[model samples]
Target: MNDEGAVTGRRGTRITSGSGRGLRGAGEAAKNAWRRGTGNRMVRRTGLVATMIVVAVGGIFAGLLVAGDTQADVGPFAARFSLTPSVSGDTDVQIPPLGSLGLDSHDGPAHLTVRLDTLDQDRTFALASDANGLAAASQTAAADLRHGVILLVERSIVAGLLGSLLLSALVFRNWRRVLASLGIAAVTLTATGAAAAITFKPSSIEEPTYNGLLANAPAVIGDARRIADQFSEYRDQLQRMVNNISKVYSTFSSLPVYEASPDTIRVLHVSDLHLNPAAWAVISAVVKQYDIDVVVDTGDINDWGSQLESSFADSIGSLDVPYVYVRGNHDSAVTAAAVAAEPNAVVLDNQSVTVAGLRIAGIGDPRFTPDKEADRKGGSVPEQLNASGSQLAATIAAAGTPVDIALVHDPASAGPLNGTVPLVLAGHRHAREVSFMPPVLERPETRLMVGGSTGGAGLRGLEGEEPTPLEMSVLYLDRTPALQAYDEITVGGSGTAEVTIRRHLAAGDAPGEPASPAPSAPDVESASPDPGTQASPLTSRPGVTTSSPRGN
Candidate 1:
């Protein structure tokens, strides 16, 4: 050992290690102290580190629990689409996924599922704002919000009001500190921008052929602007086309009218206007043009003759001719009522009108029907006019008015009313223009007049045949006013129309001659009007008692 009791390395001298031992013993003592010191320091460090680690883990778990607890479990999910008003105060709004909404993909049905609550909220939103413009803005915002996830915080930030307010509030605090932070952030941004310019200038996106963002700026900008302009122009054109398309959206039916041999009787034939205003316009125009004597519309005039309000009357006002509308399967009592409301219009469910020397009859527009009222039917037209063919025939038999030209809307109605009349004016098969007379036991001389007029069909078939509106036939008469033939024209487009009328000469009695005597009308079944309200006959079944308006 050394004199001072210090540990020392072997140097052929007394060791610095003390404790009455040699250098080996002293080294051992020093080693023991070093081990003890190192062990204590390590223990303290480890304890601190372990404590921190455990606390960090516990804090994380607690945070997770809080977050989980705060979150509401909105189990199943569905999306809202649109809301449509129903006749009743409310409707069960049918949607996909059976009943209540649940987890589902967005791409579902042609329609969307909407909760009534969301709809009510939107209605209120539309009414809340005072500023005219701002009000519209709010409504638009609410609509967009309702269709998406609406988060108050996200909306506030996106709207910028929250950020502006926050900045103002921060100004109330350490102004210098805020300014310094802002300055530093600005410097950092500037430096970053400069560095980016230097580093990413000619980046991996470099192209050899195109000089746009990389090579040419003005040319690219010009091209982009031109493209945007063209896009806008086309978009405007598309919008215009859409509006124009709506004009004929409901072109349901068109009636064609022409004059017969006699100076008194004219003919009205029509089909598939569906009560469209455009169609009715053409119908009324054609009826007046040829001095139509009588109007006969083919079937489909009414879905079920129950509820009719295509505003056919407004168009009917132009007609001087007596209009007789037949019931197609679509025709209903309501259709009859609407038609009958016209001063000169009549509902011939399955009946005839004998004018002059011809016995003319008409049946309903021929179409099969499983449900009467299911086809977008509304109003009270049906209850006003309801009568069967038999009843109409009986009335005709009594009136004994000879019908020179039979008017019918549906070609199917022509079968029953054929033969009784020498000429038939009927409509149906809207797109079909050249319909020939069928083999009939009625009158061999009976010729069907097919009008190829647009009462609407604004466009022609791609194949170039658009002879829909002018399917009318103009029949000229000899001295006896005998049927000579007809002059016809093919009409196309919305501007001007043309009809190619063919002359129809029946029997061997020269061009126009007496065909046959008018037959007795058949019995017509009539219903009582609105049994609940007790509506009396409109006019006590006009001459010969055709059908009582009181008929249901």
Candidate 2:
């Protein structure tokens, strides 16, 4: 019995030892699996943070690079200028290929022609410059343009980055999600940039590309400071070119404002002067030739509405006829002040004025920056203009002053008053258009006449591929104070001096007789001709019978 008990105790001890060994092996396996899982999680987290950092940094850099490149690609103004350091003391400035501004590397301003959409021919401004002057002016203009382009590029890049960040904040709820998304975006952008670089590798690497007329030109190593100094001096000189243009226009004048008869009254309509001093000459000539008793100017007389531009008002004051004015989207209180100071000027903002037995009411645009809103795009009528139209209509209705003519700068603003008045005159479109109000709108005979740019887009017109034309209208009224007939004049450059004159009968049903045509040989009609072409003789008299449509 004692031997059997010892054997059973030994067996029990062996069983207990084997169970303890098995438990130890299972515990080691569990610890190894946990370590592997934890290690993978840590690796993934580290990689994600690194990716986010790279994406954020690379995206910003790529954005800036693209902005700079785009800015550098577009040259400012119509002309491209190149300045090179010559062995001689004078710098060699070349204006490659001629442009609308009539900029030539060899020919000076004496031979420069200004092609406008307003004139019948390419008009010449007595710029009166030599080789030295041209070189100096080109240098200055190039510098100013370069500075402007740099500021534009920097602003664009900053705006883009800020917009992206704002958009991300709005889209992402959590900080981690934002970071992750930004990392992904950065990776995508980097890949795109790499592909672009491979496709269009730059050929030149000697110098950095710059914006403006001085593009692709080599840097002047030794005389960089001198070149910079020249820019400052030439900037003033370049401004003189504008002044010179103004002076040339100032020299032209008409005979005098007069009426053909007591039963008939003639008026000159102009708009969108935009600070082109040359407009004075056109105005003077038109007034004299048409025997205009009054002149109606629909706003935008000045471009920036600054006090400095007020001097152009001197031309308006010089017009012998009654100058009736209204404010436009481009005009400001400063412009109003300037126009008010004119001896013959009458500024009518939400007010009425009498000229030649006709009551004229006017309204100013509501928004100073008409181009800021989305409605201003695609040549669609601006919302502010619609609002202004409502305001004008309300003003006219409240006064109940029998406004014969409603004057506003924007045609959109004039819509509300279209059927309420015999004539609604506006100017913002820079193109002449006549639209007759439908009978359903209340008055079937009411007409809206939109004038082209009278200032011919002023200095602003010369900046782009196409310049606005010089345009104005001559209206004839009989004893009834109703529009009898009108002439639409468009003057501009098209390989020669070109003038397009369209005449139309009154759309209104007021009592009146067809007035006689514009006086024979109006001096202003044939003022500026092309270099070699003969000035067109003003032979046809306006107010003649025509079957032309009343509106476009």
- Computed on alpha carbons, the lDDT of every model, listed in order, comes to 0.40, 0.57
Distance (Å) between predicted and true CA of 437, model 1? 5.9
Q: For each candidate, what TM-score against the reference?
A: 0.39, 0.49
1-552 per-residue lDDT for model 2 (tens digits): 444223335545433555667899999999999999999999988976665555454545444444422222112233222221112111122232211221212211111111111211111121123435444545665565555444543443453354345445555456775656565654544453344335432232223333222331223123444544443333333233222221221111221223335577788899998876556766776676556889999889876555546778888767788899998776778779988998998998788877878898998876554224433553544666787778778888898777888898877776677567888888888877776665443454667778889877665454444445678988878777777677776555422234445555564323223222233222222233244543222422533211111110
By summed lDDT, the worst window of 10 consecutive residues in model 2 runs over: 107-116
Residue 187 C-alpha lDDT in model 2: 54
- CA shift of 346, model 2, Å: 0.8
Deviation of model 2 at 356, angstroms: 1.9
Alpha carbon deviation, residue 338, candidate 1 (Å): 1.1
Which lDDT tens digits does candidate 1 get at residues 245-297?
21211111121222343453434456555433445544554454455555566
lDDT of 1 at 243: 27
